[model samples]
Target: MSLGYFSYPMPVNEPVLQYAPGSVEKAALKKTLAELKKKQTEVPMYIGGKAIKTGKKVRMHPPHEIEHTLGFYHEGEEKHVKQAIDAALKARQSWAALPWEDRAHIFLKAADLIATKYRTYMNGTTMLGQSKNAYQAEIDSACEIIDFLRFNVHFLSEIYKQQPISSPGMHNRTEWRPLEGFVLAVTPFNFTAIGGNLPTSAAMCGNVVVWKPAHTQVYSAQMFMRILKEAGLPDGVINLIYVDGPVLGKVCFSHPDFAGVHFTGSTGVFNQMWKTIGENIANYKSYPRIVGETGGKDFVMVHKSADADVVATALARGAFEFQGQKCSAASRAYLPSNIAEEVKARLVAQVQSMKMGTVEDFSNFINAVIDERSFDKISSYIDNAKKDKKAKILVGGNYNKTEGYFIEPTVIETKDPKYVTMCEEIFGPVLTLYVYDADKFEETLALVDGTSSYALTGSIIAQDRDAVILATEKLRYAAGNFYINDKPTGAVVGQQPFGGARASGTNDKAGSMLNLFRWLSARTVKETFNPPTGYHYPFLKES
Candidate 1:
């Protein structure tokens, strides 16, 4: 386990389980989810290895079943933010001074724990709290999180092993130093994996973190901290808090020791934070690094030569998986008019076969959107599309939230490519499609580019080699993660690093070396072997 001066280890993507009927994974997930559903507990705010409870509380409920209470979290105030930041700063010196190998050992152990010991519990909590089905929960809460930990461990070593090339007379070295102060990780609620990754990656790189996960994700976020603690993460290294966004921002952004922010949320919130940082730039000891991944208006373009079944399957899975909550999910599409009907028929059948209900049901593929707010926003879009003259509800467009925040997988076909649904980021299980004349393939590509400001994820499905090559070259900047004959969703950890350009994000591809670079500052060192050190250079000699 301890062999190497410098070498790159191949990072493996954690294999996803099928969780089929009567399989071990299915049985384990079902058993754990039922146990969690019956238990109502209080989630505490952890700071410096201690759990502090506040009187004010936020009751937690499953997004799919609103009536059922999963748990309650201790709502933190402004005081907690300061305390967390202080806690992180206090732990900074010892954590950063530790050897890189020692730090790598802790995170590698964490990866093993998540992949083996805590897999079922984490997946079950994600399914119940976040409304992800068995398969979805397994891929996100268990597999992806494990991959992040393992790959980051390797990457951390890679960073340390990197040194500047030295000349014959002098030796030069580069040090990747952690920031002088604490890091703040503001994570989203969609993927429990990202929620874990935002904080852990920075902490693994020897930076102390003040992690504030989205309130809706606290149920699993609590479990995430538990696993990290069990895996031997030290006290005060990562101070976990649950405070209001404004309160947290006001304090953290204004603090002198606020070094950086690892954020994955809405563009509006990110932009506001960016402005605040700029306004308070003079207050910080060092320049703060802002790394974020925001909104996406992803698309799927189908050429005439595509396989109808493949195109339909891709749409069904890409647009409807996790209720289309991924930032990379396909929200719009362009199809050739000649084969539109054939593709539509197959797509409708695939959508019709999906079951929308609670995550406990193994047959159910579509679950509820995150909560009431999301449910309302998505329903309004569907309703508005129904009233539009150029739009038609081709297959599914039904919604009921009495029992749970349920919205059926909806498909809106519109004659106008500029329809609101086609351009906007709905972040729901709704797909808007426009069928174009087969000859206007190039023109349609231009429409896709100009349609939305967010350039996140997209796919081009074509059997013809020429069409595939043309689309690849033409729409290079359109998507950060572009697919060929496949769906835009499900970007893997190592193989297909994910992010986008434009309004989508800063395009710092997570799970890659580039993302890690943002958390580091480089310093070059030089030492001369000879004692003839003089300020004058050889070039100063006169002939």
Candidate 2:
């Protein structure tokens, strides 16, 4: 029995070119995604009603632990970004003027169309570009997008029909409408669902969006835009561009028509965007809105009364799903001293048994990290943990790059709760375990809040009714989705709106009506038929 952890190359199902310099499949994939041909062409930056090819390009690699080039994305320049912004500004007037039902219909049709024709491409792209397993890619890239688009339409309609009160001898009504300008949306590469979220939320509210998608998954974003357009979304209503952060921020911040920004990324980037918005505050034509969902170092707190089997399953999913790359991914666990040994045994057993292989294989529970950069980061963390005298590798922690960026599911047991590994966001298939005495349950909860910087997603496994209630109430701020005897990941749409608090996010919780309100501005429209030919004048005189 090897306790050192296992690593494997991502096996390919079809013929894939060796990640060589100029292979035919490599060229073909790039061409298919980027070049605009007589039939299907490679993708480009959608700006000002046309696809603009860039002088520079970004290369993408297959995530299946296979040696092949995914494709290249057009590295859009400042001009393209500005053009996209201009187009969005121009489109907003007509889009905002459309009746609410018409606006809702566009999103509904777009959602159904994607589920029909484009799901395969979206899922396959995530599997290749994001290094996610088949199930993860399908869930994040295809199903979640469909959920947001469909659910938001219903939510928007309900909000649209809401009306305000009227007073005696007077008529008054209030309505919520789109902001009178364009919205700038910046998305992360971790989930295809986010691509739909940041832009679709505003677009559904009749605000045209100038969207800058993650360069890594630009192909998936392009496919989404095409589907929306085909479903009768007017051109320019949802413009897509690709450019680096600083340059794009300048356009988003300085433009008078840039009414708001919807963002999802790191805390550092969010801070920078917030500062830029501030600097331009005096020059802006309107008070701009900036909404963000940032980083997380999420935690899972467990007690001795918990079911060991349930804890094992929850730990496996929370720490290893998507190779632990999600912002809401749980990176640390706190266990009671009495059951620490039992919990560790079950966790190790489940982690060691997980298959590290291809997405299409269906049985492999884990897959490669998103890229070599992430692989190196996770690998460094494992090495550091090994060097720490207080910590020892319990199950798996190894890396192999025979094909793509692959790392084994890793669990490290730490004696000292104050260790840095227990505090930081490992953002990989790496989990740090800390044990405490059963009598110190409240102490353990405090330790969880102190060590973990995020309150994104977490869980507790306990059978005692009072204990469950106590843990849930105490750790309410520990996560956006706090589960009892269940995995923290795999939050279902419509049932649990997902997002976090504190350093995690704005707690808007995607997939619900609450998030829709963030994208709209309230308007009060009052009409008096000339005071009913001067009838209202009597009330005014009496007052």
Candidate 3:
């Protein structure tokens, strides 16, 4: 059926576009945003390549402007989850049997579509639905998602080429088969790229997927599903559904054919899923592969010789961008006493300068958190800090929810190194600072490593080469993705494959070949060119 060995060259990362004032991209994005706000559309679940609409509809609203209606999506019940699984199993064999090059081109076409025709729609939907600013939306919904698609195709192709060596008398080869059954992709709302990558990565590996995105992210998620269909993805290959997490898990986890899950969410939820899967291990055909990137209490540590401006800028962008909703957002900082005063002054000024409002205004660097529940959770931490005597507000501790859930970028200075905000993850626009003696760099590194159970991401900013080396070795396991002089966030796809370990996650390193390997099962084939008359080995007959 196949002629020659195929090679897909390594792909370069997609370039991020700047939506500057008076630029063509800026005008196009603004027009797209305006159009999206004016229309209210109805969305349905895609199962087995058919659009299925249940009467139960949930309204969609923008986080920054809750009053405005974006659209409504049909919500499904337990029966629908079962239906999705059945459809996936029905389509699994045909899809897995198709040539790998054909599968690779479908996703490659989808990436090109995102980069060109539907670029604005992707960015616009993300900006409005997720309350992300123009640049954030461009980087996430457009560039990052594009990079994930292209790079994954190349990575999976490279995986197929790996083979075992053979001796003179025999020829050996390996067949990389897709997992036996279906994969479940549970994605979060913060990044549209994560929502796209979770499902497509597994599907690109010849696995059928049952995708359930966060309710808050359905607006953009549906757009991507339509794009996949247009890119020649067959029906039932990736079934999109809307249902409660418990109900979805009840059906998928207990099913005998459930093969794996690709997840991105909170730690508690991931823990519960693992527990349920373990409890139901006897029902499955094979051991399920569970890969997840959970929560992060990411940090930034400044050395005595660090530049004050660099430290200030890193905190400003890392802590406040996307309203600090990123799992990798810098939630805590350890500033040495030598440069503490200057860094504090500069950071306070930067925080004060930020304008918070809707995502339509490109000038506003801060936007609303995801929803009311997230808003309440983030604000409660700030309220508790106001009452505690050990902590004082450095700047920006105000919040309002009249028109939108807007919380100013709040910074807290604490005398206690182990304060609640420092240790716990408050996924919001809040940063807590703890200053230590300049001579206690090593001691503070230990404190930083010991403070949080999460080791997802952290940065060490310093001009002293020795200080950088010291932090690098001492805190080797402190973070899965470590940074120097730069912010802890903004990991590029091929250059920096992202994921973490400990309570953070399994650290499978998504956006790399390592993640793709989880979706495959290999079978080795060995053929003997010549046969002997007797069914006996040389050692048994000769000596």
Best by lDDT: 3
Model 1 residue runs over 4 Å out of place are: 1-8, 533-543
- Cα lDDT computed for each candidate against the true fold: 0.90, 0.77, 0.94
Q: Positional deviation of 38 in candidate 3, in angstroms?
A: 1.2
Itemize residue pairs with steric clashes in candidate 2.
19-67, 33-42, 33-43, 34-42, 34-43, 35-41, 35-42, 65-404
lDDT string for model 3 (1-543, tens) is: 577778889988888888877999999999999999999979999999999999899999889999999999999999999989989989999999889989999999999999999999999999999999998888899999999999998999898989999999899999998899999999999999999999999999899999999999999999999999999999899999999999999999999999999999999999999999999999999999999999999999999999999999999999999999999999999999999999999999999999999999899999999999999999999999999999999998899888888999999999999999999988999999999999999999999999999999999999999999999998899899999999999988898899988899999998899999999989999999995777777778665
Mind giving the per-residue lDDT tens digits that candidate 1 earns over 5-118? 644386788889998777898788788888999999799999998998997889999998999999899999999999999889988999988777777777778778878888
Two-way TM-score contest, 1 vs 2, winner = 1
| Total backbone collisions, model 3 | 0
- Global local distance difference test of model 1: 0.90
What local lDDT does model 2 show for residue 50?
81
Cα-based TM-score, every candidate: 0.97, 0.89, 0.99
Off by over 4 Å in 2: 1-41, 530-543
Quote the positional error of residue 304 for candidate 2 in Å: 1.3
Q: Top TM-score: which candidate number? A: 3
